[model samples]
Target: MLNLLSGLIGLVTLILMIPAVLPLLGALNWILVPIALFGAFIGLMSSKKSGQYFCLIVAGFGALRLFLGGGIV
Candidate 1:
């Protein structure tokens, strides 16, 4: 159940990330990273590892984007 919810959250966050990747819109990652982390936390509560890993990857991507953008675009 928690894993399912986490996966869903990750999917939503991934979709949102598309727009955040735009040159001047990297600032959106500020909001996305936390949401991805929240999903990862939820996934951590599940018995399986897939959802947790997926969320973590999403969070990582968001963090990388932020870093590359110098925290903002």
Candidate 2:
């Protein structure tokens, strides 16, 4: 149950981050990348049992960004 909640939260966070941060990535000179990645890292680290789910959510967003050429749909 906790894992499920973490997964949902992680997924929501990843989705929310795209539109909110992508624009700033350029204006902020890429500084936000590390911050965002670090936040995701922290989220994963804090949830030992749901770490994989968080990582998967992060990776899935990365892959989507790579292939889709845009933010989450």
Candidate 3:
């Protein structure tokens, strides 16, 4: 399902946010947060209840990271 895929992306993004993990993933840590946020946004915009619920959790974490980090600062 599209929702499921998006949620998975959120999970992976969380993993990638860690500096130690990002190198293992061979990705730039700076780029992953917004990708996760975009996935969460897509999930949130879905009409399905499951999508909304899962996305809320992922998005909450993503928002917290953004808040604590310099994403908005």
Estimated TM-score for each candidate = 0.97, 0.37, 0.50
C-alpha-based local distance difference test score of model 3: 0.58
lDDT of each residue in 1-73, candidate 2, tens digit only: 4455555555655655566445434233133334445545555555465644564556555554544444322
RMSD of 2: 6.3
Where is model 3 more than 4 Å wrong at Cα? 20-29, 49-73
Model 1: lDDT equals 0.94
For candidate 1, which ten residues in a row score worst on lDDT? 48-57
Candidate 3's TM-score: 0.50
Q: What is the descending lDDT order?
A: 1, 3, 2
Choose the strongest candidate by lDDT.
1
| Index of the highest-TM-score prediction | 1
* Higher-scoring candidate on lDDT, 2 or 3: 3
Error of model 1, residue 37, in angstroms: 0.4
